[model samples]
Target: MQQIINFLIRNKTFITYLVLLFIALGLTFNAHSYHNTKFVNSANRITGGVYNTTDAISDYFHLKEYNEQLVKENRELRSKLFNTPASSTERAQLPPGDSLQERFKVYPATVIKNSYSKERNYLLVDRGSRDSVGQDMGVITSQGLVGIIENTSSGYATVQSILNTLSEINASVKNTNNFGSLRWDGNAPDVVQLVDILRAAPIKEGDTIITGGMSSIFPKGVPIGTIRDFTLDISENYYIINVALFNDMTTLDHVYIIENLDREEILNLENTTNEQ
Candidate 1:
C-alpha cells in the first residue's frame, strides 16, 4: 500500500495533466457541432469495421452448412424433374396411361474418394445402405452421370466409375430411338465410347447423348455427354462414337444417387417370365 501511494504521488502532476486534457477535449467536442460530428463519425467507422470483420469470419465458418443446404435443394428439384410426364424436350413418348408417381428418388452425397486413372476405377461416397442407397443404383451429378453403386455399408458406398473398363451404361442420342451401350476405353478420363448405335438415325457431330431408359437403373433423358466424333465399325453396320463426358471424372465433389422404385417389381416379373 505504501509503494502504491508513493507511485501515485510521484505521477500526480502527469495524471492531473492527463485528466484535464481529457476534460478539455470532451468540453470542446460537446461545444462545437463539427467536433462532435467528427468524433461520432470516427467512432461509427471503427465499430462498423469491427462488425464487418466479425461477419465475414462467421460466414466463412458456415460455408459447409450452406453448401449442404444447396445440395438438398438441388436434389429435391431433380426429383421433381425426373418424375414428371414425358415432354417434347425430354422423352419422345410415354407408355399409355403410365403415371410416373415416385418413379425416382434422389439422395445427395459427397465424394470421399475418387479414382480415374486406371483400367478399373471406383469412387467411395459418403452415402450408404442406411441412406436408402443400394447396389446398381445410378449416381450422377448436375452435369452428367457418374456411375452405379457397386457396394454399400451403413455409412458409405462404392461407385463403379464410368471410366472403368468394366463399366457399361445404356445411353442414346437425344430426341431419337437410336440407342447404344456406353463403355469406357480407359484411355481418357473425359471421354467414353458408345457402341451399337445403328447408322439409320440422324447423327451429327456435337449431338447430345442421354440415358436410354432401357433398364431400371438410370431414367430416360438424363444428360450424359456430347458426341465428339463417330465412325462406322468394320462391317459399317453400327457406329462407334467417342463421347466427351459432361461430368469431369477427375474433379468430382457432390453427387446424387438415384433409386428406381419399380426396379424390384420389374426384375421379379422378368424372372418369373423367364422361368416359364
Candidate 2:
C-alpha cells in the first residue's frame, strides 16, 4: 500500500493530465451536435459490419441444406409435370368410341443410386415393394424413358437402365403407329437403336418414337425420343434408326414409376388361354 501510494504520488501530474484530456474529449463530443452524430454513425457502421460478417458465415454453413431443398423442389415439379390427372371436364366427356384407352398410374420416386459408366447400367430408387413398386414396372423421368424396375426391397428398387445391353422397349412410330423394338448399342450413352421398323413406313429424321403399348411395361404414346438418323439394312426391308433420347441419362434425378393396374389380370387371362 505504501509503495502504491509512492507511485501514485510520483505520477500524479501525468495522471491528472490524462484525466483532463479524456473529460475534454467527452465534452467536445457531447457539446457538438456534429461530433455526436459522427460518433453515432461510426458506431453504427462497426455494428453493421459485424452483423453482415456473421450473416455471411451462417449462410455459408447452410448451403447443403439449401441445396437439398432445391432438389426436393425440382422433384415436386417433375412429379407435377409427369403425373397430371384428368381434369373434371375431360372426365365428364368421353368420346363415343374411345374404347381402347389404357390408363396409367404414376408413382414418384427419387434416385438414391445410379450408374452410367457400366456396360449394363442400373439405378436404385427410393421406393420399392412397400410402395407397391415391383418387377417389370417402367421407370422414366421428365426428359424421356429411363428403364424398368427389375428388383425391389421393402423401401427400395433397382432399375435396369435403358443403357443396358439386355434392355428392350417396345416402341412405335409416333403418328403411324408402326411398331419396332428399341435396344441400346452398349457403346453410346445418349444414343439408342430402334429395329424392325419398316423402311416404307414414312420414317423421317424428326419423326417421333413412343411406347408401343404391346407389353405391360410402358403405356402407349409415351414419348421415347426422335429419330436422329437412319440407314437401310443390307436386307433393305427395315431401317436401323438411331434414336436421340430426350433424357440426359448421365444427369438423371427425379423419376416417375408406372403401374399398369390391369397387368396381372390381363397376363393371367392370356396365360390361361394359352394353357387351354
Which candidate number would show the highest TM-score if scored against the true structure? Answer: 1
Stretches off by above 4 angstroms in model 1 are 1-99
**Please, what is the TM-score per model?**
0.67, 0.65
lDDT of each: 0.80, 0.77
Q: For model 1, what is the C-alpha lDDT against the true structure?
A: 0.80
Which lDDT tens digits does candidate 2 get at residues 21-102?
9988876655343113223221123443454455456557657855785687689888876676668446536774444434
Q: Which residue pairs show collisions in model 2?
A: none
Any runs in candidate 2 off by more than 4 Å, and if so which?
Answer: 1-88, 92-102
